[model samples]
Target: MQTEASPLVDKFQLTEDHDSVFPKGVPWVRYHGKYNDLSINIVCPGKDSSLGVDSVGTVSVSLLTYASVQALHPDIIINAGTAGGFKAKGACIGDVFLVSNVAFHDRRIPIPVFDLYGVGSRQAFYTPNLAKELNLKVGKLSTGDSLDMSPVDEAAILANDASVKDMEGAAVAYVADLLKVPAIFLKAVTDIIDGDKPTAEEFLQNLAAVCLALDQTVTQVVDFIVGKSFSEL
Candidate 1:
């Protein structure tokens, strides 16, 4: 289980995370630059080392500016985050997931007219085939501003083969589609949204990923990249 280290530390052997399993000086380089040809430039919601909320307007401006700077017309852009699980079944407190689709958990289109079918709306999202080959668990990921704890919210997420829920996924999809790129997503299932569940050991960081979750995710992405070494299809 590991949180991410800087690319230089993780890739170029510059340093290591405190809990890194690697023997000192043995240099476990987990992040190889050739990430399915992503040429990825990650821009988390932040200014420096801190996780800036960068909500709404800030998120838009930052992403646009970063994308422009990287000259990245990405084939895939992923918005990975830690999320509270409405139903963390077949999941642990820190299970990592591949989110193939995300919905607005709080969305409801009211029908003003009795005769008119209120167009209930949500987005259908998919990762490139790469996600399937990564062998990570994939499912519907619902998003909303407030932590969705209502019975309706539980039912909405449970209405599918969903694993978890979050906030930023829908926005990421909107932006990536606008840029003509596939926006992918993942969530490290953090806490059960249920109030009665055993209090989680302040084990997982609030915004940063759950340790085991991030490790598994990185492993999957690494396998995806390594397989491309020969498959190149």
Candidate 2:
């Protein structure tokens, strides 16, 4: 997780650690500083206690987002990370996307209204100008806990018309929406799920480059947001 977050840490010089503001036992990292006169807070759900790895997925992101919202009351939450891209949607390795909407493809409930509820689709804060100005692709993003896609998940993703998929974007968006905070998702493609290469192999091979792309793109987005009214976005 830190590996994926490293580039932003370096780029923004977000070096003032705020990890101690939380309880001693809290398992997350927080850094607060200014980027071009706008206060910025970067929170990363830390390693899981038992497994000793990044606490990724919907659960962790939801909890972390709730906690961060309570603590900082940010105007907007930016969910920036790496994701699996769909070649069918014209995604290429290292391409970064500005997610227009987010949904949960893995949340399958077989009932009538519940089936729609299970999808949990939510619109991300619209930033058409930002997308156009940055020349970033605008797409729908699907979230699921698993890194590997299954037949069922694939079908659900296709139904959602997702161009990119990740573990935490929709979860964060859900929490932000619940807390009445606008949210944006910026995902860089780490692997092409539709490609012939094994998912894990491709993800590992392209992760570093994708992280760099994510960092640069996020910086640009931040720069664009600075000094602009929320209505302008």
Candidate 3:
């Protein structure tokens, strides 16, 4: 009833990547080191090889749907991708920080929550215990239709006490809550985003690498879920 199978854009091709340590592939979808109790459903945006993803909400919902339909309902949902880090924290390029909280600084009730487009929304923040496990990297995740990071936006993120901004964290939290599942965001800081024409190529390449205490974040994410295959933890 919850929009059977995937509510994502109708486009996808599941080839095989045996190069992964998990089951079908190392990424996209992988098996947890657990003995048949779990596997990971890794999803990314803006990647040429990734399946159809029109918006953050769509991708998150579809991944959840796919997991349920395929009976791969992961105990935890991990959102891994690239984000623009605010300068306040001196975030290094390729650093991996776990999202402990997501503040929706875009929402406002001009008069009183009556926008025809929709009410600006917010996502559920991470638990304090989870934060401790993830190494306590506070960040702000900004969501928008495009990757345009302006100085004004950067200032806004900094003002909101955010360390990084992304397009999908809000959507992922939106769907994960509905299914009552836990989701941890593992984001890699690529560059200092300021008001300018955003470059998709650079962002995607950064998503493929790391810069922060990455492995720990990954382990914490995997351990939080039903499937945990992190080599260290």
Candidate 4:
């Protein structure tokens, strides 16, 4: 069994935040050192992806994530936040998901040379044995530069077999892959894609609840990570 000195519990880096997106009563800093670590560091990349999904947002998230990885050099990097789910695929509002794989949905490049980058896939690192202990759903999460998806976009996302949509999962995964660091994502569903309500409306309505659920889920994942045997990590 793991102990206080286990590498898995030695450090952690968290990201994804914005004041408007995560209002008061959200415990953004609740997971730190609850299990014997010195502390758990948190970083807010910038504005929420809802404001815009341009290069500015992506760059901010990537840079902050890269900086946090270098600074903490933690055993694991977790990107925890809220996302929109595809109700067609059973992603209902207020649900939490442990991202299994992530890809970009809005990065279509006609040129063959860049097609691979457009749809790049990255797998999250988590102990399969431990994952079985959590009650969260697991599936592909597609990242894009838009909060709302058009019908055409929804079709493409469904084709990719993505169950959830978010703005920063791919960017975070990409940075972790480049740095050769282990990473995982825990996201709560705040809206249902293609639902009758507008994306923003549903997102705001469920933001508080989603934040709380994410906090609880993140804490569980952390506890599981720290409790793992060294061999398992």
Each candidate's number of clashing pairs is: 0, 0, 13, 0
Candidate 2 lDDT at 22 equals 64
Which tens-of-lDDT digit does each residue in 27-64 have in candidate 4? 22212333455346555543344553223245567776
RMSD of each: 9.0, 1.2, 8.9, 8.2
Which segments of candidate 4 are over 4 A away from where they belong? 1-34, 46-56, 229-233
lDDT of 1 by residue, 90-155 (tens): 556676777766665555555565212221123444445655666666666766655535786666
Weakest ten-residue segment in model 1 by summed lDDT? 114-123
**TM-scores of the models, in the order given:** 0.61, 0.97, 0.59, 0.78
Model 2, 1-233: lDDT tens digits are 66678778877888756546666776889877888889998888989988888898999889989988998989899999999999999999999999999999999999999998889999999998899999999999999999999999999999999999999998998899889999999999999999999998999899888898898998999999999998787
Question: Which parts of model 3 are misplaced by more than 4 Å?
Answer: 1-37, 43-71, 103-109, 114-130, 133-136, 150-159, 194-207, 211-216, 223-233
lDDT of all the models against the reference? 0.51, 0.91, 0.51, 0.70
Which structure among the candidates has the greatest lDDT?
2
Ranking by TM-score: 2, 4, 1, 3
Which regions of candidate 1 fall more than 4 Å away from where they truly are? 1-38, 47-71, 86-88, 112-133, 159-161, 198-212, 226-233
Error of 3 at 22 (Å): 20
User: Which digits, one per residue and each the tens of the lDDT, describe model 3 over residues 153-226?
Assistant: 55555655677777667666666666676666777777656424255655555543443234445544545643
Model 3 / residue 142 / CA error / Å: 2.0
